[model samples]
Target: MKRNPRKVRWTKAFRKAAGKEMTIDSTIDFEKRRNVPVRYDRDLVQTTIKAMKRVGEIKARRERAFFKNRMAVSRETQRAHRRKIIEGVKAGVKLHEPMSVESPVSSKVQEKIKVTAKRHTALLPGEGRSMGMDID
Candidate 1:
């Protein structure tokens, strides 16, 4: 009995869309064809293979931060801050100094954003339910 050759499958998308024509993806070495797909995150595969082959050693200090680096508080501190703001306003004091906190987001800014968002959420007079952008 005789068997025929099976067709190769392509499971990879283009690296970057460059006009119309053939795609440039030579991730797999097809000198002798295997049953795997052509290209899928080639750089990731290369790095993984290199890592697998090495007896890995520790590197420099990791700059990455864990989630616990930022502390989360509620109610008390928030209410105190709000009271301070209100007192500042009532005492004829102008809140002009720019509060520069990390990630361009301070508590005051967040409160303002929440207020604006609430105002926007409320339906205007005779306004339809759908008045937002269509992502599609």
Candidate 2:
């Protein structure tokens, strides 16, 4: 392939200014001939462009590092969520309790009036207790 002289000159100029390579796309208009900057010049053709391997390696390394950080954050978030659920269970927060329109003040007062679990209870200790395992 013989590339046009004008296309070759413009491609060289674009690469020199941008510090990157661009291929002359003769199919398109001359003003829009230069494509996006590539890691290696596509004009000279003998074998594969040398810089392509380095560019690919750099991209792969960056992608791996990004996913690694993302996974770490995801794991941390999951652990924190699990810890919160456990703590809520320990505090007697019925995690799976269905929502209903009940008076907040009345419920609080009723909780105080009710006999403590230690003092008196109809059911046997730990007989029907649950961890409220609804994890929606």
Candidate 3:
């Protein structure tokens, strides 16, 4: 079967994804959600370009290397390696694992706090409980 790749215009701008990640999003009720932004770090990519040039190409070890040099690029030119590996795919190099609105939680921490009203209860095992917890 003949194959034709989808063409997309490239620019130095953040393009939002047409759809949301099904894994990261799951709707139970009839509520609706907006699409998550597909962010790309144009600046970071520029930084990586600078870093790569500065480091130069690293010498691939001589010992029986895993999966035989797929790109067969010289240790003198690094971009040559990436060019051979990634062909035609635009916007190369993934920028981090993406962002999320949720905060990271520790597994050992409790989710909710239980408040009990006591007139003479001890607070810190000996500090004597306060009258009430002012959440203000």
Candidate 4:
């Protein structure tokens, strides 16, 4: 039996789309050989990709903040636990789950990111068209 070729991934499509110099009539064809056609207008794809990247970036920043929050909480808990141990307390250490404490600055930044992503994803609705000028 012969093995089939691997399908083109969306990441590759995104990369291709990113570098493409698109025009009004240009389009980004997704899985061109498949029967169930899925296509994107040039402007729409560009905008969507931009929004996706922005969201990813924002999420990355949030992840860093979450880690920082976790570490701070962990350190405080550790100090308390050590103090208890030094005081000759026989009670088992009470572990506290790290909760993300949202700072006002971080919250405001996240809100702005959400607003930007929303605006970018809200593309104008229009008639769909067949893949015309291929970007790939």
Candidate 5:
């Protein structure tokens, strides 16, 4: 079956078109194929290898930054959607007003309740003899 490269999800063309890949980066330009043939020198080969590694690192860093920025925007949109849902839920429910402590009914309720402090007794010097033995 014939498929359009730009529309195919797994194609490089699609990724570039969808802004999922870096299209205008200097590191990307370094990876382009050259038609001209060059004489192979040991120093040139070593320098080219180092340059390739550096370019790969730069590309990876830029890709990470791009992904982070994309995810940040996605997170903000998700937060806004959640806030809207919460607001809708709040609108559907009826909230009761808080009761005041100084109200007549509240004062009567408080008067009906009793609060007591508990006291603990400490052992005297003579009571210390039973500390080590268990009694039935």
Candidate 6:
């Protein structure tokens, strides 16, 4: 069985059609096959190699920029969708009472209180030393 190149997801045609690849870039033009025969010169070959490297770099940069732009748009849409869901949830939910204020004792104060209570209990006569050693 034969498969259409345009329909295959991995094919260049499909990627170009789907706007997932650079279709009309100048670097892309450099990649086309030329049937014309040229006399091989050492200088020409070296220049061609340099040009190819430069073109590859330009193409890669352009592709990265394109991908970043596409992902940015997707990220924005995802953020908007998440915000919409949160808003919907907020609208449907009702609190029975007003939200409570923070405790009179701050977190640091609570932690210090707990530590002091533990120290006091540990120092008590009946209770044995933790880990066979006094923790003072």
Q: Which parts of model 2 have CA positions greater than 4 angstroms off?
A: 1-33, 36-43, 46-48, 93-136
Error of 3 at 24 (Å): 64
Q: What TM-score, to 2 decimals, does candidate 6 have? A: 0.66
lDDT score for candidate 2 against the true structure: 0.58
TM-score, candidate 4, is 0.34
- What's the residue-level lDDT of 92 in candidate 6? 98
Across 68-113, the per-residue lDDT of candidate 5 in tens digits comes to 9888999999999999999999999999999876766654455546
TM-score of each: 0.16, 0.34, 0.15, 0.34, 0.66, 0.66
lDDT of 6: 0.87
Candidate 1's residue-wise lDDT over 1-136, tens digit each?
5332222222223212321222332322222366777577989899867754442221111111211222233456778899999998879975687865666656565552434334455544444546555445
Q: Comparing candidate 1 with candidate 2, which one achieves the higher lDDT?
A: 2
> How large is the C-alpha RMSD of every model relative to the true structure?
24.7, 21.6, 30.2, 33.0, 8.6, 8.6
Predicted structure with the largest lDDT when compared to the true one = 6
lDDT of 6 by residue, 1-136 (tens): 8899999999999999999997888898888899998999999999999999999999999999999999999999999999999999999999688667987677775452434333444444546544445555
- Candidate 5 or 3, higher lDDT: 5
Scored by CA lDDT, what does every candidate get? 0.45, 0.58, 0.45, 0.57, 0.86, 0.87
For residues 22-117, what per-residue lDDT tens digits would candidate 3 score against the true structure? 222222122345388646799987986875554343212321242244334444367766786776454566557768766588668868878887
Candidate 1 stretches with Cα past 4 Å from truth are 1-72, 93-136
Report the error of model 1 at residue 132, Å: 40
In model 1, what lDDT does residue 59 have? 14
Worst lDDT 10-window in candidate 5: 124-133
lDDT of 2 at 119: 60
